[model samples]
Target: MLRAPGVYRPRADTRLLVEAIREAALPRGAHVLDVGTGTGVLAVAAARSGAAEVTAVDVSRRAVLTAYLNTRMRRLPVRVERGDVQDPSETRQFDVILSNPPYVPSEQPRPPERGGARSWDAGSDGRAVLDPLCVRSARLLAPRGTLLIVHSALCGVERTLTRLRRSGLKASVVARRAERFGPVLRARAGLLEARGIIEPGQRHEQLVVIRGDRPEPLEGPEACGDGT
Candidate 1:
């Protein structure tokens, strides 16, 4: 059953995350972190993919409980926790971190049908969760590790990339899908911009999967030039 705020239900996007992580070709036995482990979909996938250890976290206690149950059902090796993405105690460090954060920007009052906390909302621009996730990722990811984020293109992909770069991480677009919001799409960016969240002239509807890799000095320009 799908949950409120568009998170509870399992969707194709979750499967996409699993496929993308597998495509990255991470070594077996590597420690993995599944941020916002929602229904433990990615966590279970990682465990099945041969991760040595998988730690899953969600800010919602209910989600955490759900993840734990799901992990038990699959009999996967996963440690589930309840905490915010920015919490330092979430874990020491990880070899791989994956997250499908709440991607909708909060441009206006949430609908009566919507319960704010059940969904990922970052003020007027939807970066509330993502911005902090990026910062924490910089600290949590091990050297040469990878962090994958799936988000809607309507939220400002370029700006997301820029933030990742400023956070001492290299960001790039990994995947995208074109979706229509019809007449509602026209006012999306404006609603956010009116609140000074988005700058003028930003277009919506372009979900993307972004990848950020931990830096390795040996792989730097000097090493590349050394050619040895």
Candidate 2:
């Protein structure tokens, strides 16, 4: 397993996203981008699944380095970069984009600027990253591209679906797993309950994988452009 300070470790949510990626049936040599690739687990999985190219992005330098080292150890040709998915600079659209961003609701309006909390503490509504990610995913995907994102249901699953659908993409919940709250969620249980996001004494949250697919051009088949 990969190890790094301030980097998110592989967890149930990560596994759920990986399983969803496998079920997506991506075309051979499809270009894949993994946003918030904490340990590059999904990126490595995509490479092993026959992706022609895999690129991973994260806002944390430590996360980028950790992912880079992890992918290298597996001998996977994953390109790891320090960047935010909401403001990605890469012009090429990806055939598949995967993300497991921070979704735990926090009392603060913004995520921490530094510290281990950045790995899981999202804003007050838990949409700080998820919201922008939905907007950017539409632009980052190529025609007929697929986007798979995993987040806690407490963050508003319907909201994510609504946002993606509003962006002209077909979105749905593809997979879900109910898991007991870990350290992060446990710590915020009171606040979440107070905000009525969770039931009193509730100790479990459902993690869902939302899939958004861009429709192919109707004017005739289009060739897959090289993902720059």
Candidate 3:
């Protein structure tokens, strides 16, 4: 797959999310959406897994192009767009939503709007991207749909779950892996220690994949109806 230097490369986190996708066991012909699709890896995976429609969105021009070209070359039917996931092209809902957005904590005050860092540097608390995703993404799912997201546990897994649940989805950590600090985090270890995000000398952090499921609508006797 072609990728610009500024695009997020498919790595362990991406592969882990893919595993979770397969485990999701989406129904045939399910519509899927991949937010922050750097190379459209999840988008392609969804198409290969029998998604009826695939739509991918990213804020970077290079990322948008990288995803578009990758899916195009594979002859997959994917609609790659450039924008926020909140403002997708249409009002359609998806049966499955996937994301591996910027979650690495950084000293940067705000998330970057461009460059490769945009794929990982999420901000001082690492919730700049996560916060919005947790708060707004549940509405994009169809009834009984699922949303899968992966990020470093340092960013606050509980907070993600709380936000998703508050948005009406049942959320929980579905997968986790302990990984040594990568180059970025290693470089920021001092900052992490100073902020008490990690213990002084901690060298590893947990990566987690969280799944949020939207319940089917109430029906029959349990459903609220107009007072008779």
Candidate 4:
């Protein structure tokens, strides 16, 4: 896979997300959306997994171009767009949504305006992007759609599942892997320990893939809200 400078390179998290998508066993004609598609890895996986339509979105120009090139090179039917998934104007829903968004907690007040850090840096608690994504997930999904998102356990996996459930989706952890702290996270170990987000001497973080599923509407009387 060709990657532009600073774009997120496919790693364990990416591989896990791909695995989750394949296990989903979605119908062939399903529409799929890949948000924060750094290198289009997940988008390509969705296409190969049988999605009839695949849309990949990213906020970085280089990432958008990289994704387009990768998909185009593979001759996959993926639409690459330089846009934010959290945008309100994005009303088109999909049968499956894949996201490996920014989850690294940073002391910065906002995500980076440019450079590689933008791909993984999220404000303070790391929920800067995660929170919004969880809140907007169900809206972006079509009925019976599935949302596959990967993030470090340091970001609070339960918080993500809880937020998704509150959005009316059935959410759960689909995959997890413990990995030694990478350069980025390793550099923040002191701060993380100080903040109590991780135990002192912790040199590993568990990455988790959370699946949020939007269920189909109930039939008959169940469809009616409130017995009254």
Name the top lDDT candidate.
Answer: 4
Model 1 spans with C-alpha error above 4 angstroms: 1-7, 108-117, 180-204, 217-228
The candidates, ranked best first by lDDT, are: 4, 2, 3, 1
TM-score of every model?
Answer: 0.78, 0.93, 0.92, 0.94
- Please give, for residues 1-228, the per-residue lDDT of candidate 1 as tens digits: 223343455544566677788787877998999988888888988898889999998766667878898888878899998876676565587988999887666654431224433445555567767776776787777887888888776567887787666666678988767654434345565675676644577554556788988786423322332211
Error of 2 at 148 (Å): 0.3
Tens digits of lDDT, candidate 3, 84-202? 97553447788999999999888888988667888899999999988878655676778888899999999998989877876777889999988888888899999999999999999
Per-residue lDDT of model 4, residues 186-214, tens digit only: 99999999999999999999999999888
Ordering by TM-score: 4, 2, 3, 1
**Cα-based lDDT at residue 51, candidate 4:** 87
Which window of ten consecutive residues has the lowest lDDT sum in model 3?
A: 219-228
Backbone clashes in candidate 1 total 2
Residue runs of model 3 more than 4 Å from their true location after superposition:
88-90, 218-228
For this target, which candidate reaches the highest TM-score against the unseen true structure? 4
TM-score of 3: 0.92
* Cα shift from native, residue 226, model 3 (Å): 22
